[model samples]
Target: MAIVARGQADRGPPRDRCGDPDLDDARDCRRDRRAVVLPRGVARRRQAVDHRRRVAGRRGADAARRAGDGEPAQGAHPDGRAVRRRERHLLHRDGGQPGHAADHRDRRHPRRDPRRAGHGHPGPARALVGRCRHRGPRGASRMTADDLVWILPLIPAVAALAMLAARGRATLVWLDLLASLGVLTLALVIAGEVPSRPIAAGPLRADSLAIPFLLLIGFLAVATSIYSNGWVRHEVAHGGMKASSLRYYHALVQAFIATMLVTVLADNLGILWTAMEGTTITSAVLVGFHGDRRGLEAAWKYIIVTTIGISFGLFGTILIYAAAAHAHGAISDAMSWSEINTIASRLDPGIVRIGFIFVMVGYGTKAGLAPMHMWLPDAHSQAPTPVSALLSGAS
Candidate 1:
């Protein structure tokens, strides 16, 4: 009589289970079998899935605690400690075999079972998993259009500091050109994103209203910086301007650009007014960089006239703030454009009218409108042509 194995053929000499001698299943015939070895790629994928599952489990527990009122609310999954305890209980029941533990739970609860948590992820956790998957195999960092919006202003601000440090070096011109181009590219990127979607980060925000100004400023910055490079070299070659003066001129131009960017990006009217004044001060120095009598006269006039105008603008900003504070009882809430525009109808009508008129006149003076346009012509004509272009187009 011949003895036959459990899964062996009933009537055969000696056939391998899968007709392959290398396979573990072919080596022995067993009634029940499980795979113990996985391919390298399959093992890696399994590890990643396990990592995601662990992260999802922890996040689910955190969400439960945050959403819970007192006890673990009705249908929510158990927290980490409870899940661990349950896992330990199952481990003990199956004599430390995890596969047997899963089978035991399925047999015990055929309808609904907590042990089935391994089946799939929770809702919020699935969303997080989707984001992780989007990061791709290489695990590169991701950026959104909203991130570029806030980064736009920082480009010129950093450039200003770099230009100031590199004062006497001839590379200042190249630095200025590269910095201005970077700002322009970033601004264009932001402008494209802003029309369909407004991007905001804390106090700085960009929308349809700000798009025109940002594009205007960004273009002017690039154009003016390019023009300044050639103009500076020419002036230095001739006796018109000193080579040492180039440092002061380049530094001030960057500072002026940064201030204008801040002005356009400011979310609050008060901050806008302040940044406008900052542009005035920085550009005034650039206007008088030649240090001639006419340049000096122009810078002085620019300072006096704009200072007086901005004072009125400040007063107007204060009046509006006071009115908004009366309505909301919070200064921060009052200062934001979104908050103020929402409650504009409820604010005092008379105060709003007066404040707006003052703001208009004050900003109009800086804008180089009639009657208040006295300082513009002298500053533009006497300053370098590049500075003139900015004063006319951007400032």
Candidate 2:
């Protein structure tokens, strides 16, 4: 009975080495309840912590990369406490983490992404940017010595026109005088003793007659340019010419000078005749510049009479060519004045005399000599004073 009691006592309490049976059972129940409840909550919390840690790690890696590359790290979340805690733990384990203040200073503020900032179409701005890049910097205006050289011829022309246009402006008259002086200087330099090359296949000569004519023309042009300024001004003041008519007048004067220069310099009779005809056309326009009935009628008569006379001159040219063909057997020799003059005595003097008659009549009409003087008085009288001066003096 005693052995049986001892065995029963040893197996008596199914407690965990404690003397209280109820307490032991309560403890085991509590443990079992805890085991059932705590595991799921702890597992969920751990998963959240792990996710936060992973995100924090990614952010830290990105920040590190950005810092190394000298670019701003943006878009990191501030409200993620778990991630912050994990980051703190990691930083503390390594060293101290950079402070929020320092990180804020180091990091740039979030900017509007360039891709999302604007509402306009993107293409034009891009094209503008490309053009800006291509053009680089603006450059200064460039002028050279050769450009200055061109101004020599241009100044006289400009001054002559300006003088005519300014009309009553006394200041411009002085300016015109200065421009003429410049032209004289240029002409002196160009008209050196160096002989001009022959234009046609004949001996080249610069006769006293041609040189004197050239010098006279130049001197007369200078005087006329100065005289025109005052004359046009008087005409304008007196209501004889309008501003627009003055412009045509000045332009025609320059054209006349250029044409006459060509005529005097021409070695070939054909070229001389062409230049003279051009002068006639240009001068006729000047004669009619006023557009009045008298001016128009004068221009008409001048043109008709000159054309008829020049037609005879053309016939004479053709006859000369015919005679040259009979003598020299070359058509080109007929066109050269020097060659014709050299062979004039050998050729039929009667035909030569007739040709001279036609030539003299044609050019003389333009030269304002004799019967052609009928149209001249009307044209000159009707034209502005400056134009009249030019017609009478310069021509």
Candidate 3:
């Protein structure tokens, strides 16, 4: 037998540790055919290495085909020491590079019994192997808290639809109460998911600022629904309001509540304004539901005053959108709270100041602040008890 020097090709077929050439090839083929069972931490590394090798091999094969060579140059010396070394490096990254994960199989003792390998810990071993799988950073595709929390606004909007479909006074009353209860329950569930700061999804957001306010709305919505049942009965019994009018009132109140819910959940200032305007339209009818001259006058005042304020808010929103486009280079980015907050310091100071002034004048009127408070008392006093509660508590 001629002994070959290191790095030289052995003058024979590749043999296993037992000196059988067929055994090594057969064992390797079996290992390749069988699924690789490895510890979770090492499995990921092996998968990555395997993927890279497959890609590289595909590229090499394509190049060989393009060059009119069916076989690669490396195929000439498959059993050479250099070829085996390269193959070993390609197949595994276990040569102790600091960045590469070390395989745990090389340890002197098994961490757990080999007999119970595939079957999980039978006697309180705590399943250490499976825990490693989930220990990595969360993937980008994972759903965010905002994705799950948006159902809060939808609950009230659905409630509004049910109110519009109610057949009679009794049905309207029960539907209103049930919808309010549903809104309250959903609000509580969403509030629990919110953290101290705002969590956002597209144009909607929930945070410490919105959650407390939403909780108040939820309570008030349910409370007013319960109270309105008796109030509607009193109005109808005394011939104060027609049955047809009460049904419209029920529908309008729910739409109003849905608008308020959307307003609080809005991440974009534009959405907030739209939802705010929605409240005005829906509640104006409720404000003047009594059909008296005084109620009608109050509702007109509420509409006229709020409309002016809303116009100012609209101008402000447009200016801000322009500024946002100028600052961030996109019209849509201008409407995003995340984008605006990110580049706020870089925005034009003059534009920002004017925009904020309009915003204040517009939203302040809706909030019943200072001079805008004129329509507040008249609208609140003339409106029904439930409508008044909603305007006072939510709007």
- Candidate with maximal TM-score: 1
lDDT value, candidate 2, whole model: 0.60
lDDT, residue 344, candidate 3: 94
lDDT of each: 0.75, 0.60, 0.74
Ranking by lDDT: 1, 3, 2
Instruction: Give residue 379's lDDT in candidate 1 (0 to 100).
Output: 87
In Å, residue 55's CA in model 1 sits off its true spot by: 43
**On residues 4-76, what C-alpha lDDT tens digit does candidate 3 reach at each position?**
2232222455567777776537655554454434566666676689899999998886566556645433431
In the range 1-395, model 1's lDDT, one tens digit per residue, is 32222333453333466654435544454323323555667667777999999999988877877677776432212332333335446645735454334444443442433334342231122222223222355766688777776678788778777877785646888888888898889888888888787888777889999888888887898888877777777888887888766766787888888888878888887778888899899988988888889999999999999888888888888888889989878877899888898898889988888898888778888888778889988988888888888887665
Candidate 2, residues 120-181, lDDT tens digits: the string is 21222222222222233578557533233234346656765665657544555566557656
Residue 193 of model 3: what lDDT? Answer: 73
Give the CA lDDT, 0 to 100, for residue 175 in model 1.
Answer: 84
For each candidate in turn, the TM-score is 0.65, 0.51, 0.62
User: C-alpha displacement of 233 in model 3, angstroms?
Assistant: 0.9
Give candidates' CA RMSD values in order. Answer: 18.0, 20.1, 18.3
Give model 3's TM-score versus the native structure.
0.62
Candidate with best lDDT: 1
